[model samples]
Target: MIEVIDEFYSAALAQETIRGMIENARGGYRNGGLPVYGYQNVRSTDGNGNQKTRYEINEAEARIVRLIFELYAKGNGLKNILMHLNDHGHRARSGGLWNKATIASIVRNEAYIGWTIFNKKDTKIYGIQFKPRTEWVIIKNTHPPIVAEQLFNRVQALIEERHPTRTAARTTASTYLLSGLMTCDRCGSSYGVTGYGRGKKYAYYNCLTYSKKGKQVCPGHSIRADELDAMVIAKVRERLFSEFNIRQLLNDLNVATRTVKDGRCEQVKDLKRRLADKEARLLRQYEAIESGKIDLSLIGDRLRALKAEQNALREELANFERETMLAPPVITRAIIERYRQEMEQVFIGENVQEQRAFLKNFIEKVVVGESETRIVYYAGGIRIPSGIFPATSEHPRP
Candidate 1:
């Protein structure tokens, strides 16, 4: 019991001494006088001397703290910003490496926001250490802010956006050729690429919804990567070489306007009816407001909603009428010739990026069905369908 009391007194004395030294240094620095700097090298008669590491808040070190705070505000998460600093050979305050915990501490420190909190955690005698937020002593405006409060809040928001509590692992790279251009005809969902087995062993593209869950959600429709590639190459070759297929595509596109004209006319009429109904509602709201039948607040809200609906309807009606009246001319032999020449250039292009660009420009989507696969081509402001059978000899080609 006596020894324990002695040790406690010694610790208390040491802490007091350190506090007095820090206060003296701070006062001397404030008064434009030299601080006591030789304490680190002060030797005692005991072992190893008092060789300790001391830190002084020099202008260069302060500048580094400011730089770190600025980086945190610029839409970079703590981990990434720390990595960038470390990569550029920036060392931490203790001349040590940077880690996630250190970066997190720097971000959460209120000192950067021009405030300091002391005694956040405390220990009394031999009892367990305890810290209550309400007991913390906060000193406001203790230091200059390195980043604005608004910018810091935005950085926090971005951090939360990137790291949600529950998130699925992002699998594929964004540069896949068929990424947004393929769909399942049965479920009308997009197809996704998946890999199987271990490293360099196996990989394939399957219906994403089915692969992640089960076949009950979707029938497991899949095509081998190599097989799909070959099919697309063959189709491209055939389309380029075969004169008959090229002519048929052009003729079909030409005839589409005449065949869909009646349907287009009905669509325009329907849009006009919708526009008239919306306009009638808007006029009714105006009359109610004019006569003071409704409160001004309620009338204003209703008027705004009605006006928006009427504007949308008017826009739709105008679009329908324009499309009906100004349909592109029917695909002709000359048009076919020009398309063939363009396609040939794409087919024989040495650059992969150019080929993918051409394919994306012409093809909207390729829908894979159980029995038939349909390629939707974007031509003359319409999606022209080209049918292919997976069971048959014909393969996919762009």
Candidate 2:
């Protein structure tokens, strides 16, 4: 019975997703997330006052789009195009230099030629598994085209002829430990992952500007992922999970709880105001009944109800005040030891993705120089568990 119900729920969710996507596509509306780099989302109202997101060309970005298509058509590979863009100071929509995958995505995106394609991947499964092209919902000329259909098709042909199925380093993009977290110590441009393929997965997050824009912009610097991931993991386990650091974590937790407690204090204040208002109303009612202005037989139930509400408010207010007065929990030795063990397991565990996530949370930014890598800590920072800077630890590049 549970399995049957779960299957039904899965089917219903898939249907709803497809239906909503198709509806949005047919109506020429841009669905959520970031719009393609060449386009910006403009909100428009229909006759019935329904606000719809419409894709409008961002002229500056469109020029970059046209240049990319033209360059690709002129026999430039993804790396060459990426280098050209970075060398010329052209940044991605997210304020980063163009990687090979970014360039490939722009080339393959149907929106360039004004088509809205949906259902590219099956979302019903536990992991993202892409659906075949035949299973897609494609609407033509949904918005203005950045490039001609002829040019777009030519680029697609070139991509197929050159790369086949976009294998090599691109396929292993997710496996890199420090893909997005590291930045160059010299120029501050992000590090791009490369140097992996041909059955041997050699991982390195090299400086982007150095790779694409030449050494003039930023020096050629690269960090070995396996060694650095190990070192950083060790440092985080030793320092971040230490009793001193756990105390900072508890402080952050207390600060967040205090915010909630302050909100409760305001709630208690509001309850008191409400109780006072109820009492004033009761007094006015008593005076009226005593003066023979209102009949007791008629107003007696209302007076009783007002008194009941007043009592309820008083009880609620007292509970809230008591809660507000309670002190935040202290960081105990047991908590620190337990947290240390759990954190050690997280790093020691085989989940690279999980390790990266935790690293990004505690470590503010990792600045890799020619000689040493500097890690800035936000041990008391981040949302939920805010942090203070414990230390800016540096280690020689392995």
Candidate 3:
């Protein structure tokens, strides 16, 4: 009796399971046997000579590409283009506002040149995608190019040219003369200027790194507007009076620079020799790989290190050429005369910016400590240290 009951229950369960399977199959057929918002059927050939489904450019995307190229050709940088589009009430295809990331994407994309690039990004551990340049597969002239190859290359060059070297924020109005010139004596970083109040405001110059990083990183030293002007004027006068000392400094600099010329030439030759040796080694390694005596994988690591060394040597050689071989004679009398004329104008100048500019041209780095401020002036390649002034002293306002 128990066996019979168990058989009956099993039969019922099997029938129900079959019914559910049939319903699922029918539903799947009705739904086209694919996910809603499924990936579009893309006709593309893979590296392994197999057809693969991938996203292709649409008409709207092609128009955007053309627009980007046109904007780039007009000397509008990526940021400016993005800002202009946003300001003009232009929306992206996704109906979203333009952003830096989107602008960068449009600028960097090479697909506008009729090439199809794949595998720009891949999934790494559990749903995390990483984009690697090395893994990109490029198919040349896959579609009609919206932008010409030459035009695209020029746009790319322009983009790279506009990339900022430093992160110093630039103001629309040029105010300070020594805005970008002043450097911190302690860390050798540029000084940033800030102002307080409205018209007839008090402006101060402080080390940028220290201001941003706080006093724990660097002791914040400041030179007030009036104090700096007086100090610079006094130093100029002092240097003018000591004519003999000024001439001696210039003569010494000239002699020292000339003496080092032969050494600089020898250094350049040595660097060239080292670079040649690396190139020969790289060539030999390539030959070994071709001959099946060495593994090609090891060559990459060796070449990277060798290339870095060669680059360093080349930089040193360049520096030697610039400093020793190309250094002009530093005439102290001429410098003094120039400084005196500038200083006189600076003292009476109505425009603060002009005054600051004159001072900046002569002063290299002004080190303001707790007690004294030391100003270093660079004439040609030689550095002349001017008189130290008390940091607490007051003077006429700009």
Candidate 4:
């Protein structure tokens, strides 16, 4: 505990120091970092008598900023803009000629429009990473505006149109039930939904390796997505997840669990120890806040995280105790029957996510061949159980 407390305070001091500096930087107060081009960092003392830095527009540089926006919006590419700026009497604040990246960055920066942001990124052990915009502290109208908001919006639209991003919309827009489970038998590549139909509304599951690399890599094997999905769902519902199969699987699980009760005491003790540690750490943070050893605002995020961990630990500890002391649920024939009925409704229902879960539970993977498909079951799950499906197009039994 002594060594742990020392290490925690060292980390806490670093966190608190960085957060205090960011809090002081809310209204464009600089922290010795280079200000964006067209803005100069000027030092001044705040009302607290502590010296700080904030951005003020450098007019000579501001004119150059406005010119870049105008030129880009007029259909000028980065190359032309770069050449135009360097050929003329313009250079970076470092007195070096401007490059394409420098020119492009000025056009994209929001600092020119008089809004300053702080805590937009965090530095972890790996490297710098951007925080979500909601977490960023944005102070508007803090400095004099150089370019109009209208110009910035126009430039942004052009930038997005030229270099479009993928999967921003398509990720949620396209959902497949057997996505992770379905694979091609020929090349062992996963089948994913691709292409649009006559009205750009329908898609198909094409072999990923073949679709990406062409027929020279593999055959152009494609299947109508709806047909394959319906067939697989039917097979899973009628064959694999049948009530007889459900009952036998539960019986097997209950028998297996009865023999495995000897190894749980150590797990319970370990969880109790972990739970106690989380509670102690949470208490320390609370004491620090009450005793004035730490600022609440600086430690609020960490405090919430610790409280969440405490809650999760409590839930886990309860589960471990219940499992060790109390018996497992009496999984009777009536209980299995009720579960089977609910599963039937799950497949027939409109909730695709629920249906997907049930399918993944019953079957491990589906290997799609030219003439047939193979459904692999989780072991000890279904009767007629050699532990694998061993079915073809002519005869696919559950």
Tens-digit lDDT string for candidate 1 (1-398): 99999999999997887565445333221212332211111212213453333223445555556666677666555545555666677666667655556665556566555454556657674643537868765555533555566655666665556553645444452334456667877777887565432342333455655443334446646554444544555565565458787767877886786878878899888888887888888777777878989676866777788888878878887887888888667777887788778877776565556666766766677677665555666642222122332222211110
Using lDDT as the measure, name the better of candidate 1 and candidate 2.
Answer: 2
Best by lDDT: 2
In the range 182-275, model 4's lDDT, one tens digit per residue, is: 7787999887764434454545666666544444445635565666677777777787566687877788868877655546767778878988
Candidate 1 Cα errors over 4 Å, as ranges: 1-175, 196-202, 245-345, 348-352, 378-398
Q: Using TM-score as the measure, which candidate wins?
A: 2
CA shift of 269, model 2, Å: 8.2
Model 1 — TM-score against the truth? 0.30
Off by over 4 Å in 4: 1-174, 253-330, 380-398
Worst 10 residues of 2 by lDDT: 383-392
What are the C-alpha RMSDs, in order, of all predicted structures?
21.9, 14.2, 24.4, 20.4
Better of 1 and 4 by TM-score: 4
- State TM-scores per candidate: 0.30, 0.49, 0.29, 0.39
Residue 361 displacement in candidate 3 (angstroms) = 4.7
Q: lDDT of each model, Cα atoms only?
A: 0.58, 0.75, 0.58, 0.71
Q: Whole-model lDDT, candidate 2?
A: 0.75
- The clash count for each model shown is 4, 5, 0, 1
Cα-based RMSD of candidate 2: 14.2
Give candidate 3's TM-score.
0.29
